[model samples]
Target chain A: MMHLLKIEWLKIKNYKAFLFISLFFLIGIFATNYIVYSVFHNIVNKSDAALLLSNFNPYDFEHVWQTVSYTSGYLLMLPSLLLIILVTNEYTFRTNRQNIIDGSSREEYANVKMMMALIVAATSTLFVVLTALAFAYSSEKDFSITGFSHVGYFFLKALSYNIIAIFISTLIKRTGFAIGIFFIYMGAENIIAQFLDVLSMKLKSSKNIDFGSLGDYLPMNSSDGLLSFPPTPLKSFTTSSLPTEYTWIVLGFAIFYLVLFSWLSRRLIIKKDL
Target chain B: MNVLSINNISKNYGKVTALQNVSFSVPRGSVFGILGPNGSGKTTLLGIIMDVLKATGGTYKLFDENPDNQLRKRIGTLLETPNFYHYLSAVQNLKITAGIKQRGENDIERVLEIVSLTNRKNSTFSTYSLGMKQRLAIAAALLGDPEVLVLDEPTNGLDPVGIAEIRELIKLLASQGKTIIMASHMLDEVEKVCSHVAILKYGELITFGNVDEIFINDDIVEVASSNIDQLKDALNLMPGNLKVEIKGNIVQITFPVGSANLENVNQFCFEKGIVLSQLQIRKKSLESKFMELTN
Candidate 1:
């Protein structure tokens, strides 16, 4: 098993796609910091200094980690699109056919590809963390940021999202089709969660639904995840604060889809002639 | 024992039949040729043997065991053109293929040399010519140093020189006592290298035998004589392994299969004063014989 994994790794190591992904997220973290500082720094000049950033440093380790991990959307689509392109191109390129002819099981081939995508995901995640930390210290002299939770949360969230993306892309070889489905599913869940919360607020009792657990809906029902929730509902929208359970739900779905795609891709091996 | 054997294997694509009750065995260390025209289930059979496609019926055995287990390490194949990662260099592409096969070594160099692509090893796969790509495909097949080689249309699109190069490589491999099963539409090539041959037509085995058995037959003796009538009359009187005919002052006689008594026949004709002008022995080529069988 290790031998095969190594082989798969070697095959994917030189792919231009992998290189592009790693670079995209690394550069994105720095870009996000520049944009945020440029837009908000001047506005804070007339405001209370403590309320702004304590004026000591906004570029502490904690803040850097947050920016890097919190802003990994650029990499969210990497795993899905990359895995799909790798798998689907086998049909058009005919190389996969050659693989089968030389005595490789389809399962072995799929396993290698999924493993590579996951590795890329992990690499991107780590790069975001490292890049954030690199800038955090250089930007600050007197203080250091604390609390790994925010940036950690960001990493886990992106990782989960990327895993599921890879799963969907592997099962459906077409890039556009898988991404379209992803958008629709995410969009529908957000809409339904909001609508249900609104209807509950206007009821005779007017009690909000406690989607307090992870099974049905997400916290603030958004992919970015919520660090804070507003006290008042400007609209007839109110719900119990999201439980950490929603994270688990999202994570579980990601795992389930990964396993499912893995199984399906493996089974497809014996179905066709090379 | 046979090196590769498929027993009563069948595969169907919806209503279309890809293979039907197909069974054949390749003996150890022999150049076994599976001869067939396009779409005659040759590739399907090779696919099943390699486990690329599942069989709808029957079982197969390789190297004295079910192919699912031991055959992978035992067999190497170049089934078609190629499906390599074009952006990667030749060495890089091979590294990936070798990795999946699970017996990683530096045979990438050995195989590149075998294919005469050692000078171009660093070049990307996209830069390879069609023949170079095919050679690299075969190089991939040789990666594991397997005991058996299975190739389908190995020279499908190569120029004559490239085809000849591949043929030489195949012959060299065979000389090392490796069992080789090659499926091809080129009858002349099969005749040149294959000791044993199986002819498939429309998903059925038309014939299977040693090369000599399939090709060995009576040789034609063409005789253009001064007097065709006299030669025919003299030949008609002859006995033992002879069939004589007369057409336009030429008396043609065909001898029994495997009989080499042409000198005896010539002496007899001279003694009879037939005055032979032209005499030539005609051996039937595999192509002509194939046309006879398939038609």
Candidate 2:
């Protein structure tokens, strides 16, 4: 495994585009998150809406962790793009063919990408943790700390997104087309989920039959369900979490999607004629 | 000992069959060449053996062991063209290869020196010429000092000097007791560098054997005299069931393998009062032989 990681590192260590794009996207996510945090903590806290929702605390150490974890999920697409480009470049440059010819097995090659996904996931999650640390301490000097599983869930969400990117890159084998189709897929999954949610709502209102919401089980939404946003003045009208019975179900679906994507990517590389 | 043994191997890309029931073996320390025309399954066969392309049917063994990553590590292969990271320097690209084979990183300098690319080791692959790219590919193949080397069209794109350089390199490696399986469309290259050869046409094996056995000593003796009529008459009287023909002023005689009697033909012509002007023996050219086999 370490040899494979060394191989992947050698491929991209000197690649200027890899360095620039990865840093740009990762820092871009943090920068965007910081700007949004400042707008809410500094400006929104003094508004008329703040009095009505006094219980909601965006600056508390506990709330800051949730705030950062929830908001960082929106920027998962950036790191996912980096993963897509890195994987597809192997095909574009035809190095994958040479790598196998040089003596690495197809499974080892696939594992190299998986390791990179793990590293990318680890790096992005660390950034989120750092952002949480900065915001949590700056907001209050004597604030009490809370649990860290939600941050861990945020890591899984980032991992799921990048693995999905790897699957798209492996299936398509073209950079521009993979990115284009991936965006289309993201939008299409949401649209399909929303349509099903509306259908379930009508079924419940008309017949009093309590069929469950189908949107929470989608590929993208399942991972998004890992962490829910804190109640703010803006989103107080919406429900926060899924039913207690369905939390484990959503988590299981998220895990199933991650494994499914990784397995598919491995199969493509192993069985391909490259 | 055989370095490679392929048995009834076949490959098909959807409807197009690239290789069909091809089988051969390369003996240890021999420079074996796979000769064929364009699209004759040479590269496809090499790709399958190197594990770059999975065969549709049949099996192959390397060093008498089942094919696997560990077995492949003992063989260095360059299929089709020189494939490397264009943006990275040759040193860095070789580092990746060495990492894959799990060899010592110190071997990088030794291979670069062998290919005479040490001066440009730090240069990016994209900046190198076609010949340089080819040499770097050879250098990559030499790392770990494997017992076998598999190269497909190793001299496909090169100047005359580069061709000679690579030919010399292959000969040098062969002298050091390294087995090489090379594929080429250039018959002359194979004729010069290979000790054994296998010819393929449209995915089927036509013939395969040692150079001397396959290219039997069928020497064509061309005798032209001042008196063409007398030369033709004298050639007809020659013994040993030789095929004699007249082309303009020359009497061309093709004797059976290893039966060229130059002295006997000269004496017969002299006694018949036909003063010979040209008596030359030409070895059968590999190009004509290849055309005859492939066609």
- Output the number of the lDDT-best candidate: 2
**Interface residue Cα RMSD of candidate 1 after superposition:** 2.3
Clashes of 2: 0
- The window of 10 residues in a row where model 2 chain A has the poorest summed lDDT is A236-245
Runs of candidate 2 with Cα error greater than 4 angstroms are: A141-147, A209-212, A240-245, B223-237, B245-251, B266-279
DockQ of every candidate: 0.44, 0.75
Candidate 2 is graded, for docking, as: medium
Per residue, candidate 1 scores C-alpha lDDT tens digits across A5-110 of: 6766666678887577556656766676666555445655346753534453334554555555655544455554565566566655676766766556666666
**What's the CA RMSD for each of the models?**
5.5, 2.8
Candidate 2 lDDT over residue span B32-75, tens digit each: 99999999999999888878789999999888888888888888
Highest TM-score scorer: 2
* lDDT (Cα) of model 2: 0.84
